[model samples]
Target: MTLNAAPRGLYFDDFEIGQEIVTSARTITLTDIVNFACLSGDFNEVHTNFEYCKTTAAGEPIAHGPLVYAVAAGLQYATGVNDGTLLALLQIDGWKMLSSVKHGDTIRLHSRVLEKKESSKGDRGVVTFLRQIIKHDGTTAQEMTAKYLYRRRPKA
Candidate 1:
């Protein structure tokens, strides 16, 4: 967290180990894939061509792995949990693409706080969260651990 930033959302003091947050769902759209493909310059057939994908194990055009990751980040932001309290994303470690996300599959993010460490400087803290992207059918499509810098509670 920045020394001068004000806290408007969940500060480090408000978080506890094992706390969890669930986000609203969003359906993956073909538009999303196309836009992501265009944005990321990933024109791979598995994610862009259904006829070509029909020959793959997933059997159809599957969303790009990174696209689903971006959507998961959006879901977290939509929850308002990080509005102002989060300073920055320090790292994304142990990211795993457990399954494929297809067009029209509704998904939600399930995030659990794994750890919190108050900075030695005392103005900020570090927090790690385990996030899972869960499909409508209750399967996890992807998972990862993200570490973030966050503001501490302001002095009264």
Candidate 2:
């Protein structure tokens, strides 16, 4: 069996509380919505059926809540803050979808490290981050606090 080497990335000690990081923007598209619907089995009319959406309050198809959340999470990773140093996602707290994400809306994640603590064994640490998914127009589409466990750097 081949040994899996640890990926080089920021360790638990590298993070500073209150440090903010922004990610590259991505535009929501019909294909992305459709793909997310297929993958998640969430074929909601507001996200898939344009005709049905016309009769709704939004009057247009909106992206799925989970889709937006997933995208925001991906954007956070794209920022290279955690990278391969992430051990596991511990929890998600106070996740709120503040506004609808519609097709053609470019969005990005703005995240701040909220808290950090070492594990009992000191082999890893947990980091709590406050993340906001903001649209190009400056509207906050979603906000959440996510906790992740990151590995500590190995001692030489």
Candidate 3:
């Protein structure tokens, strides 16, 4: 498959170690923060309180770290690289939030395949990806390495 084409969910053989995928951007909004707060029950003042956040370093409410991580995870799927071929998310490593994500910030994901190893049974492979959640101004807000299991395409 071509690099830029929409993958029909890649199989184990489709991933290359250095292949990179960029996803569409999503703007963070107050409603998103509020909804995430309600769903996650994370009501920290820095994330949910406008007046209270004015006294903090950011001077405005910031999105929750896990929320940003969740968005990044969704963005990876938006790329459609493993839409139908993914078996499971095996692990996450070295996840870090380097900068605060404030409301109105547009974010996108940049992911690169880091490693791939065939399973012992040979029906699937584990692929490791390094992902970055970047803001509109090119600031990296979060990063992590994720490992996913992908099925191998059946041989005819």
Candidate 4:
């Protein structure tokens, strides 16, 4: 990912329904898989054992699904659109892992604002988005509906 010199974040009031964001690409590597495996303690054969994978549908070791999901979130954050305006991740719904991403696959995040709602007290709001992880070959490897709490724009 290319580093941003000035990362701008959008407040709750700035998001509009139907708005889309496409982030820069990042390539998956064996080191990423190994690090994730060590961090998550999920050394599943599908992700850590290549020899064991030849017997499975993947035919070779693949990155963990959750690792890809995490990467997608990282890609979104790297865009700097939510630098400080984002308060917290409220929820994730309808998450799906449609395909497997392997080492060397370049991926990017596609995020679309689905809806936004103001808090009852007007101090914060929630934004719902449809986020997808798209691989270099144009395949959507994973997708989910993510709801995030965001602070409202500060009044002058």
Candidate 5:
């Protein structure tokens, strides 16, 4: 799905339960894996070593789960409402790593808004969603349920 280029802050009125937001695709390259390994200090052989993978059940080098999650979260942020309107990401629950992502895999994230409610103490409301990270070929790699605090629309 093509995202809006115009910056529109997501307000309480913008989200509806059961609405799905599809994020842009991002491809993971070898350089991305190596760079992520250096930045995150995760030097696990399963992610960085093809030789080690030959002995493991994965049978080949794989991307780190967190790295894949970061890509997915980036997509979620680019959806416009979360980055422009969010005060904070309050909670993330039920995050499951389902499949292995190898190098050169292009992935996409899809988010379904599950609930919305006004916060009692804050000027914002809470938006919660179930997010799915899918491979370019349509395999689901990971999923998460996350909640964020988003600003309410200003009084006109």
Candidate 6:
């Protein structure tokens, strides 16, 4: 992949099992939650009602878990790691929500390459990453293992 300055794109061969990639941070806003709710049809009270959440362990309205997952995936794309020939996004498995993500809470994502293997077809390779969504306080709120298929760079 052609590397750019801001997005931090990484090519197919640039990733290793333990390499960590950090993305630009974003804060979850009430508007964001409401918009997501409208789009996804998840209007759970805990996610949209402050009064209801006040009595819950979250203690406040929180962002949807799927929204947080989307942000983590967006981080990988925004950081330039998704450049070049991306054959497919294979899967995102083993997702876990470790903490509540509230409105106004800033979050960042970090992905560590967990495995890489050449495809039998030889045109692409599989890359699996351990993705973590962490709050500004460095607490992990979400985690997942995402896998993708990337076309190998043409031999010179």
The residue pairs that clash in candidate 2, if any, are none
Candidate with more favorable, higher lDDT: 3 or 5:
3
Superposed model 2: Cα runs more than 4 Å off: 1-8
Clashes of 1: 0
Candidate 5 per-residue C-alpha lDDT over 1-156 given as tens digits, one digit per residue, 9 for 90 to 100: 997664376786688999888988999888878889999999999988889899998888888899999988787677665656778889989999998898888999998999999888656798999989999889999998989888887666
Please provide the root mean square deviation of candidate 2 (C-alpha atoms, Å). Answer: 2.2
Error of 6 at 107 (Å): 0.8
- Give the alpha carbon lDDT tens digit for every residue of 106-143 in model 3: 99999899999999989999999998999999999999
Q: Which sections of candidate 1 miss by over 4 Å?
A: 1-7
TM-score of each: 0.94, 0.91, 0.93, 0.93, 0.90, 0.90
Candidate number achieving the greatest lDDT relative to the actual structure: 1
- Kindly give the stretch of ten consecutive residues in candidate 5 with the minimal lDDT sum: 4-13
Candidate 4 lDDT for residue 142: 92
Give a tens-digit lDDT track for model 2, residues 1-156. 999876756899888999888999999998999999999998878888989999998889899999988888788777777778999999999989899999999999998899999999989999899989999999999998989999998898
Query: How does residue 89 of candidate 3 score in lDDT?
Result: 92
Q: Clashing pairs in model 5?
A: none
Better of 1 and 4 by TM-score: 1
The deviation in Å at residue 7 for candidate 6 is 12
The residue ranges of model 6 lying beyond 4 angstroms of the native Cα positions read: 1-9
Q: Runs in model 4 with CA error above 4 Å?
A: 1-7
- Model 3 is weakest, by summed lDDT over 10 consecutive residues, at 1-10
In candidate 5 the C-alpha lDDT for residue 88 amounts to 87
